[model samples]
Target: MTVESRRLDGNAAAGRLADVFAFDATVARTRCGGCGTTAPLGAHHVYADAPGMVVRCLVCEAVVLRIVRTPGHTWLDMSGTAALDIPDGDPS
Candidate 1:
């Protein structure tokens, strides 16, 4: 699908990510493995309407991040990102 119709932003994944990350995961920077694009998670497009969360690259329209929350656990996958640079911080 076109990125616009299927994309939101990292803000939409805040709540679900709180349980997994101590800091604002959106602020972290990552490089898209598909197109060698780099941007903060906040700048990436996010899709939350599905059964889980899907973050895609704004430039390449490729999957950059995905999260699935099950009843017992949350599954997070960042395979589409070539590199992730999550700064150290405590947003609490």
Candidate 2:
């Protein structure tokens, strides 16, 4: 995955991602990288920051994941889970 260094405000970046992925909203899920346990997660206290952007396990903040939007659907870069597959729109 190509990580763009260009900086974008959290809201704008999230909006762009949502538009790209065609998702109404992004869900947050935290999982333990070691144990593979997952749990519901909430927005960080300061989501605009990099550390705040992480999704950590409720029981153990061992695993941190970031959810990003794709052209077709939402995806978790860490777990490689895609919410849905969307076809590209025709330009014609």
lDDT of 1 at 41: 85
Listed per candidate, the RMSD to the true structure in angstroms reads 2.9, 10.7
List, residue by residue over 1-92, the lDDT tens digit for candidate 2.
22333332224335534544454323434344545554333331113345324443434344344555446666554452222223345559
lDDT of 1 by residue, 1-92 (tens): 87567667777777877789887878889899999988888888888888888988989879998899899988999899899888977669
C-alpha TM-scores of all predictions: 0.84, 0.33
User: Which portions of model 2 show Cα errors greater than 4 Å?
Assistant: 1-31, 43-48, 67-76, 79-92
Give the residue spans of candidate 1 off by over 4 A. 1-6, 90-92
User: Candidate 2, after superposition: displacement of residue 92 in Å?
Assistant: 33
The TM-score of predicted model 2 comes to: 0.33
* lDDT by candidate, in order shown: 0.85, 0.39
